[model samples]
Target: MLQQETALQKLWSWLFENKVMLLFLLICVGGVAVSGNSASFVIENVAIRFGRNAFTVMSLLIPVLAGLGLNFSIVIGAVAAQMGLFFAVDWGFNGVMGMLIAFLIATPLAMLFGFGVGRLFNKMKGSEMIAGLILGYFADGLYQLFFLYILGGVLPVKTESLIIPGGIGIKNTIDLTGNMKYALDEVKLVDIVLIFFIIIAVISVFRIIIKLKNKEQSPLKDLIILLLAAAVYALTYVPAVESMLMTSKLSLLNVFLIIAVVGIAYAIWKIISNKLNPDPKFKAIRYITIIVAIVLLYALTYIPELEKILMNSKVSALPLALIAGLSLFNAAFLSTRIGQNMRTVGQSRVIANASGINVDRVRVLAMIISTVLASWGQLIYLQNLGTFATYGAHLQVGQFAIAALLIGGASVSKATNKQAITGVILFHTLFIVAPEAGKVLFNNAMLGEYFRVFVSYGVIALALAMHAWQRKKKPSLELPA
Candidate 1:
């Protein structure tokens, strides 16, 4: 009976912890059903939306880690990206070169904007979130002033297409169709793979050097993992495998099979590693759960309708790689000294300061990093979108990204890479299906649009409220006399 009670408690805890994710998952499933959209259509739309928005959403993570809550000031970073794009277009830079130049221009400008925002946040401290929101509005005004009064009026631009009739202000919309459309997305898959290999090799060499310098044991495990991964990648070179992969769209079942194979391999590795060095903390239940999930996913691929949807979805290779890279970076950053400082500062400024860490500096660094990332994310979004909305493109960036993060069960004090990725998928899935669902149920597509917008704002508000309530309920530390 005691054991049963403990098991029940554990189940309850898991449910409570994952309540938001589970709810969103259910809503997405229900929305898809009600919308009556074909699975293929939804899958295709979600794949495109994910490529466009994932990076911007992930950009919010660092500020949250530093206890700055949602960085609404990411709009400022978006502005910097637009400015770079403007220059890139005005100079007649096109294709991949244009995108690269825009990135180069955006980076320093974003850094500058991020630095200023960081300083302001340090002063605002407890109210950094609100301060950032207001700063975005404030920055927008300056942004308009520069583009309207200064860009063409004070500083002439060569591009007539970008200038208004009176030539005083820049146009409200800039077409990137010829200049930078599909710049990143059109990158050859082979180039991306080659770059990935080079990056891995570089990192491996660096790690070996560090190990040697420290007189530590050789990183045999790391080398083994790298070799194993390379071996798997090499299988793609087989004529049959290569021909299949070269197709415009891959079968959904194949994708699931690939993932299942990787998961099974990892699970086997864990079992062997556990045998060699037993860990009390290791739980076989996790592997069991993962295997179950893989099985379910694989089973879904066997369903005809689901299979069609999966096969029909075409993902952009470079953008997907970038998203994965950013996720990996988030995980890697958290293990670094600076990331630890951000975490420490986030937990309690008083404690962080007391521990001789410069809390203000850490917070500033976090904002700077977040802002710079937001700039790059905006670049990715615009390049994929193939058009630049000079004035309106960035307006909803912060709100939507923050909402997505919050919807994924992230709070003001805590978030993770997994939560951010999951939130993007769920939030965007709802975004894609909600309007159709609304139209189906209520005969009004607008209603669905309103509902999704409401969900975006509502989720953020709910997270904030929950955060405040939790703080109030938390017990304060009391020193004994």
Candidate 2:
């Protein structure tokens, strides 16, 4: 009976820990079913939405790490990107060049905006989240003022398309068709692969040199990884492979197979390396779990409906690659010195200060990095969308991103790249199907739209409430009188 009670408690803990994710998963499944959308259609929409919004969502991570909850001020970064886009379009730049110019223009402006936000956050230390939320609104007002009065009115601007009828403010909407539409998405997958290969090669070589300089063990593992990467890059040049990549879309089955192969290869490499090195950190259970997951995924592909969807659904490669790169960046950043400092400060500003760390500077740096990334993320979002809503594009960015992050099981004091990516997938999946699900269930599409919007805000509020409740429940350190 004691053992049974312990087991039940453990199960309860597990359920409590994963309640949000499980709830979202159930909703996604039910919504997809009720929406009456084909599996392929849902997958396609989810993939596209993921590509469009994942980066912007990711831009919230750094500030969260620095103890600034949610970084709602990232909307300022979005506004800066829009400003850059406006000037880029006004200057007659097009294609990738326009995107590049916009990025260059936005980077400095975002840095400036981020600095101010950081200073403000520092002043309002414990209340950074609320401060950021208010800051976003304040920034939006300034953004409107600039676009409405400063652009064509105070400044000399002859761009007819951008100017309003009264010729005082910028137009409410700016079309990016022919200019920067699909600019990054249109990049050849082969080129992206080659660039990734080269970066990996360079990093590998650098690490190998450092190892040799220190007279440490041979970098056999690095060499093997580089070789594997090179082989993958080489396959891209094969006529059949190249043709498949050049096509606008790729089969989800092929994509899944590729992922499975990569996973298997990694497992094999880990096993071999473990046998050779006998690392104490190796976990048999973890590998077993991974192997089981891979097998289950492959088995699911055999189901007739799932198989049809997997074979029929296609996804673009470049945007996915970009998202993967950003995810990697987030992971790698945490291993660096600044990331360590940010983590230290996040855990305890007093301790961090006692450790000789400049908490304010670190927080400022975090905001700058987040703000710049947010600017770039907004650019990616707009280019794919091919339309810039001058006055409104940046409005919901902070709220929606924060909501997604919170929905993915992240909290005020802790977040991870995995959580961010999971949140993007789950949150966007709900966004994609919720309206249709609502319509089917309630006979009103507007209800679904309202439901999704509500879920976004509701999730954030729930997470905040939970955080407060947890804090309140924690045992105090004071001794009894």
Candidate 3:
């Protein structure tokens, strides 16, 4: 019975890990049945509407990577994007040109915002997650001030369409239809731009890290890992009787990224492997296996049916870049030697000083990274949404993003990309279906809204309480031991 229970526990953990996929499946089935009366319309409408939402959802993955929590302040990025849109409107840069210009403008703003937020977070140290959540609220107030009081009055907001009726500030919502709608719809194919950029970025970063580590660390094991990964990517990109173009074209940039990543990994592996005297043959097997695994990884994307369903969908390249970039930020915070130093400084400046790490410098860098990711995420999210919420736009952004992440199973001290993605999917799915589901089952859509609010708050409370409880229990457990 104990063994059975243990097995069940393991199964439960696995389920938790894959909760998003499970929830997605359940929602699809239940959604279909619930709306079966108009299944076709529901499918067509929901897919189109939600597809527009994918980029924002994907944006949440970045701060999670950077170990900055869920980045509820990503709305800062959105605000930056909105500022761009506003400017584009002023300049009469219509359509794609306007959208492109907005994107360009948002980039610097995002970076600036990210740098500031990152700095603040470093100061807060252990409390970065909660700090970020609160920061979102503060930023929202600023956003509202700009949108409400400044834009039309102090700043030049020329277009009546964008301005409010009284003419002091911008309208509650700007009509994005003619301005920036589907600007990149053509030149930015879901395939070439989005996938290519992601693959290239991921591969290059991974390779560079591995290579750098190899120079100072171990070699054979790292080499094996790189080779195996290369094999996987190579295999996936290989053309059959059909042309290579027919296959998933691995972009040159992606190839570069992959090389950089493998290089870095190799360097790291060699260093680690050298510290432990393992059999030389074990090292050889390891490299072979590493190459094979990477090859397999890239190859996995080649399945015709799966690729058709997943890869064929058009997505923006910007979000992918943001995710990759933010993840590196998180990686820096979490696992890196520098990251450990940051934590040390956060815990005790005196001790960090004693340990010989530059606490002040580390703190600054941490802030810069966090804020930059925040800025970028906000931009991606706003662009993806193609609209702004005005006073309430950035208000609960930090809260909701943090709540969603925790609900999806991240604790304050530890979060991962997987958790952020899962949380966003589940949280958004609930956002979509709950009201309707409530209306269908309970007779009032508002009930679903209430349920959502309850769950959102409940998750945050639960996560915080859990953290406190664990902290309290640690002393007791250690005392007995």
Cα TM-score per model: 0.88, 0.88, 0.63
Q: Which one wins by TM-score: 2 or 3?
A: 2
Candidate 2 RMSD computed on C-alpha atoms after optimal superposition onto the true structure: 3.8
lDDT of 3 by residue, 359-397 (tens): 656755654454444444444455456665555555555
* Number of the predicted model whose lDDT against the real structure is largest: 2
lDDT scores in order: 0.83, 0.85, 0.58
Better of 1 and 2 by lDDT: 2
The residue-by-residue lDDT of candidate 1 on 1-481, one tens digit each, is 1233466666765565666777788989999999898777877887888888999999999888889988899999999999998999999999889999999999999999999899988898799888999999999999999999999888989988789898889988898988898888887665566578767777877787787788778878668766865775686788886665453333445556766998888887897798899999999778878878887878877788777777767777778778878988998998899888888988888999998999888988888888889999999999889878889999999999988887787888788888888888899888888888887888886787888777888877776776576557443312223
Q: TM-score: which is higher, 1 or 3?
A: 1
Q: How good is model 2 by TM-score?
A: 0.88
Kindly report which residue stretches of model 3 are placed more than 4 angstroms away from their true locations once superposed. 1-75, 94-97, 114-135, 184-187, 190-340, 343-351, 470-481
Ranking by lDDT: 2, 1, 3
Which segments of candidate 1 are over 4 A away from where they belong?
Answer: 1-5, 207-255, 444-448, 466-481
1-481 per-residue lDDT for model 2 (tens digits): 1233466666766566556667777888988888988778888787777778889988889888888877889999999999898899999999888998999999999999999999989999899988888989999999999999998879967678789898899888999998899888787767777879999999998888887888878988888888998999999989998876665455678778877887877887888889998989898678767877998989899999888887876666667677777887888888899889999999999999999999999999999999999999899999989999999999999888888887787888878877887888888888888888888889987898898888888888887787676566443412234
